[model samples]
Target: MSDQTSMISARGLRKSFVQRSRKGPGIEFEAVRGIDVDVRRGVAFGFLGPNGAGKSSTMRMICCVSPVSGGELRIFGLDPATHGPEIRSRIGVCPQEDTLDNELNVWENLYVYGRYFGLPRDVVRDRIDELLDFVQLTEKAQAKVDDLSGGMKRRLTIARSLINKPEILILDEPTTGLDPQARHVIWDRLFRLKQQGVTLVLTTHYMDEAEQLADRLVVMDKGVIVAEGSPRELIEQYSTREVAEIRFGVGENEALAPKVEDLAERVEVLPDRLLLYTDDGERALQDVLGRGLRPETTLVRRATLEDVFLRLTGRSLAD
Candidate 1:
């Protein structure tokens, strides 16, 4: 059963594809295993995972662009299988790639997309104006798509997605390939959208991006959800209150790891550094010093979402 208050609901949701080999029988590959998810309305929800973790497959199913192999998925309390068109009309999608038309000017691209929704010429024109202004692209309305910068093109694609004034907006890797300044600009725009009561659905590999944007998030791995919670809750649950990062030149981490094992609750040995997870990073560092171990450098900081990911999956988000 679907939750009416939720924008999206999935129960035992699964997706699979057939892989055919020239030398053998076709094999079935499961991209998404049985999983349950509920995205409440009027909140930003995020999906975080490493590559091939089935994030894209799940997003495609929610957008109704790909059919679910099994289980139930509902959008706005409507079955996507029978109400795909109705569901799509009420949602906007900003894909991973900026699929803008290079032949068209900024305004024309949005105009063409609005027309696809069967919106009236007058309404489309009015919508284009509002969207361009909202995305801070009004000044570039007549600029050729080929002449725009990467950030501009991304913002334009976001504007085009909003031509229908959708109630739900789905963004896939929204700020990838953008500079820090440009990424912050896009983040501001998304923040405004969420404040306006449009539910946001996002997938990102950037831990900081997930922390900043997602009110609630799920961490997926090997086609299944490993954990779910708000950023702070997840950090508190999976990580210590603080982390001490220590560096001791090259090829020294492995040897030093065991030496510092008793300093913190847990110790992780990386290629070039060591992470000590404990409630008091400063105390851990002092313990290390008292043991006559001299680290080249040390940093103590509060635990972040990245720490949570490392603790849960034993892999970096980029992996």
Candidate 2:
């Protein structure tokens, strides 16, 4: 889509930082190399990569918290440099860390954040109740922030971010430390927000989370975007239909890799298992056994976003 139609647009966007070195003059470290991006209105766009892959830097620029070092960027058709305050007012940010004040209660946390947006007490109080209920934190509204569970704190943070009823919501590792159940609750809330026509932008380490939440995503590595597509498009482009996982005991995977290498389209020998990429995992396993090789255990599964990342980056997404 053209820049006019896109909610967020970038052309050769870049960000860099000056690093002070002990030996000599400070060096320049480019966190986000020049890249192009477009985030359409009301769609969930995700930035994904391993640690220090420019995802955070890009998000910072999008949120108008960090100035661009080079290239052009526009949020809501306004340059962040000139309209930083306006852009910030139109968007909500949920950072990776829980920034809630432990001294405040759950309701108080949202109350204070709304007031920061210059909202009137009556409006802020009303919005606080709506947000708390939206994030399923209404029952815990009177409880101390420090006493809330990790998931509750995360939900409260999300509620606080929405105090101004922003059109765009940016989340950084939204469910980093939450359990599966908690993560699902967070996902449900986010899904509802998206349904309400809020544009969702996020960065995540969990491949499954990306699959569930992102309509389109980009994979960045070493300060550049390496891949961009829907999760299924990415998997289809980078991986096979199925993956056959075979464990030949702890140290035997590498040694036995060659024996099954020709049985599938490709073979990846991890330290603990051999992943055979092929269209038919069952046939590949039978081929292994036909060769008189008996694996300690075997599992056949469909190719996923993680497999695509492994193929593109030569490592797990979390690594």
The global Cα lDDT (0 to 1) of model 2 is: 0.91
In the range 1-319, model 2's lDDT, one tens digit per residue, is: 1123688999999999999989999999999999888998888998888889898899999999899999999999999999998988889999999899999999988888888888899999999879888988888989999999999999998999899989889999999999999999999999999888889999987899999999999988888988999999999999999999999987889998988889999898778899999999999999998999999999999999889888988888877
Please give, for residues 136-189, the per-residue lDDT of candidate 1 as tens digits.
999999999999988999999999989888888999999989999999999999
Candidate 2: count the clashes: 0
| Candidate lDDT values, in order | 0.91, 0.91
Clashing pairs counted in every model: 0, 0
Runs of candidate 1 exceeding 4 Å displacement: 1-4
Worst 10 residues of 1 by lDDT: 1-10
Which pairs clash in the backbone of model 1? none
